[model samples]
Target: MIELDNVSKTYGSTRALDSIDLTILPLRTTVLLGPSGCGKSTLIRLIIGLIKPDEGSVYVEGELLTPNNIFALRKRMGYVIQDGALFPHLTARENVSLIAKHIGWNRDRIQNRIVELCGLTKFPVDALNRYPAQISGGQRQRVSLMRALMLDPDILLLDEPLGALDPLIRFELQTDLKEIFKTLGKTVLMVTHDKGEAGFFEDTIVLLRDGCIIQQGTLSDLVKKPADPFVTRFINAQRSPLESIQNKADSKVF
Candidate 1:
């Protein structure tokens, strides 16, 4: 369980995050959804200990999450940022094996891990031998994901992992990722501006606005009872039933 108690952050006069409290459930996907600059990235940064809160505390599994403890905690957490942050010079296999080598794993062990990750993410065996410049965007993203999962961290944080892909490829990866999560049962926290993406992939949705949580609940809960007009519009815009209604309204009557 990840807990944030009255977390707040400020940069000079501008407040990036207000006094926010949240408890993330384990072994499930929880999505943070909102428009850009609404503090979703800020929340993710704080969770990963990239930045510290000006006030309050963060805890993982009953232990206080401080800079001193963050290094230890990171070993048990995986973070995937937007875009495939791969090394252009390194081949896919080398990229995936990099982390294992850092932790003093032997050559045989690293090779085994690369093989396992390649199988898990469905990357072509030959593709592993090629550099990032040689693969498609989707493949690069998959390699990034495999690298992130190299250690099998309990907590996985994804920031717009599919945001850079084309619609069809994005949908394919989204489905693949969902299935992987179901099989692994890891705790996942993802930030996305796409409402449909959130609804399709997450078990819980957290809506944010102006550095605050506007609402949070299951998709069914929010769909049946939106917290306010913004949420209603957001849901309506992405949900299929609402799209069908919009299509009907725009249909030609001859």
Candidate 2:
């Protein structure tokens, strides 16, 4: 239920997004996948009102996002940036309840919401007192998700949510995140650079390069019917270490 019409953003000499038009459909996961400097995060910032576009407009739920309505509209969505961005000085429970407290939620209401989110995100109740540094990377990510979902927003925006975790932890979070998405059935707009991760979570993948969309479709569509040569190369370039070892083994065989 988000629409970007001819959106453009520039920073001095560089253009982060150029005349981009995209629509993030409701009740499905739409992922922005691309290499570094491809404007994925910029797109998210534009929609979240963190940064305004130089040209064009951003609409959420059929209303234009203006300065006056930005804060109120923002409350309709939950955002989780990379690295969790948790407050180091606060405990996990405090961190998750920060926004709710700021919005004047009563103690009982806040406590109930936090408890419900803990179960939804699979975060342990015993670890609520722990600080970010005291927990594992996966637990930290879970805390971040709990905080994001505390408000029960209509849309969820995750910017490279698992980028900092180890492979095993990342895989675990991926599975949990996918299931959470299905359970919540909210509009999801996630940004990621990993093709495999995008393919795993994306109902529609939007690949970008040089501040423009290169292709937008399913993983199978991108693989079998590439819109450009770059798409083919981009899809094939992310081979695993096992594939690399297999290549070396084949070269030495008869």
Candidate 3:
């Protein structure tokens, strides 16, 4: 659904993306996995037209993404950031309806969409009147998702959507989000540093380092045949606390 051809982006002397080529398939979840400064967020910004590539081009479907068509094209995609990015002054309902209202959606249509998204994200209807500060972290993320889906975009780009939540809440949202992705079947490209999160949600995992793709494949493929030592280390370097405890119990080494 999206394609990047020889894409490159630079800030001063630092290159964020270097001669990168990637194709994101339709109706599937793809996770961009790497450590900090690996250019995952830069790639997302390029796709969203938040930042233009220094060289090469970005295409959504078949059309090139340029300044002239960016505004219209962005309407076909929904974005969510780590902090929910809600306007603190607006109520949750208002936040979700911002885009619809901007595009001149009638009251009935806006209300219906808000109701539908609240149900889809399991957000409390009564809480819709509350401000972001009045809600829990989980609720804030839900509100953000509701806002993103309000337009029913063809592609979803999430940058650490659950990164700020507590472990339990994050796990809960992860499961629900996977189900939602399956049900909607929209093209999804998410950036996450967590290996477990990538394993859970990714149909394909694209591993990057120093602004270049090292390998792109399933979790098993990455584990069994790492493209480089760094890939293996990145995959095995992180383990949940529960998994660590279980490993100790299994080995009787504690």
Candidate 4:
């Protein structure tokens, strides 16, 4: 549903993205996996029209994403960033309903949508009146997600949505998120550096390095036949301690 054609972005001397050519298919989850400073976040910003590319074009459902059309185009996509990026003063319900209210959704519609999202994200109905400071990290992210989905956008873009949570909470949210994605069937593009997280959401994984896409495919393709040594290293670098020890023992036994 989204396409980037020869897209490139730079910041003075630093290249944030280098001639990126990517196509995000409809109703599928695509994870952008890479180390820090590798341009994953940059790509997300580009797709969301937060920033313009220096070279080439970005298309959403075949329409070119330009400054003039960005405001309207953005209404068709939902975005969730790290720690939910919630307004500190707004209650969870207010945060979630902000966009809907701005677009003139009635009170009944907003409340109904909030109730639906609370169930979908497993957020407590009672906590709707609580401020961001009053809620847990996981709940904050859920609030952020609800806010994003309030408009019922066709596409969802999440940037490290679970990055700030505890492992257990992260795991729990991951499972819920996978189910939500499947249930909604919206085109999803997520940014994460964790290899296991990428594999868990394994519809397609795009590995980036130094602002360029090094490889794009399933986890098995990356593990079995890496395009470059960096791809193997990147995957192996994030292996769990137990997995690392097991790999060593298996190698010695063989």
Which candidate has the top score in TM-score?
2
Residues 1-254, model 4: lDDT tens digits: 99999999999999999999999999999999999999999999999999999999999988999989999999999999987889999999999998889989999999998999999999999999999999999999999999899899999999999999999999999999999999999999999999999999969999999999999999999999999999999998876889889999999999
Candidate 2 residue lDDT tens string, 1-254: 99999999999988999999999999999999999998999999999999999999999999999999999999889999889999999999999999899999999999999889888889999999999999988999899998888888999999999999999999999999999999999999999999999999989999999899999999999999999999999999898999999999999994
User: The CA-based lDDT of model 2 is what?
Assistant: 0.94
**TM-score per model over all chains:** 0.93, 0.98, 0.96, 0.96
- On a 0 to 100 scale, what is the lDDT of residue 147 in model 2? 88
TM-score of structure candidate 1: 0.93
Can you tell me which runs of candidate 1 are displaced by over 4 Å?
Answer: 238-254
Model 1, span 41-125: residue lDDT tens: 8998898899999998989877898878998898888888888799889998888888778889999888887788788888887
Query: Scored by Cα lDDT, where does model 1 land?
Result: 0.88
Q: How far is 37's C-alpha from truth in model 2 (Å)?
A: 0.6
Per-candidate Cα RMSD to the true structure, in Å, reads: 2.1, 1.0, 1.9, 2.3
> What ranges in model 3 sit over 4 Å off?
246-254
The weakest ten consecutive residues by lDDT in model 2 span 113-122
Residue 72 alpha-carbon offset, candidate 1, angstroms? 1.1
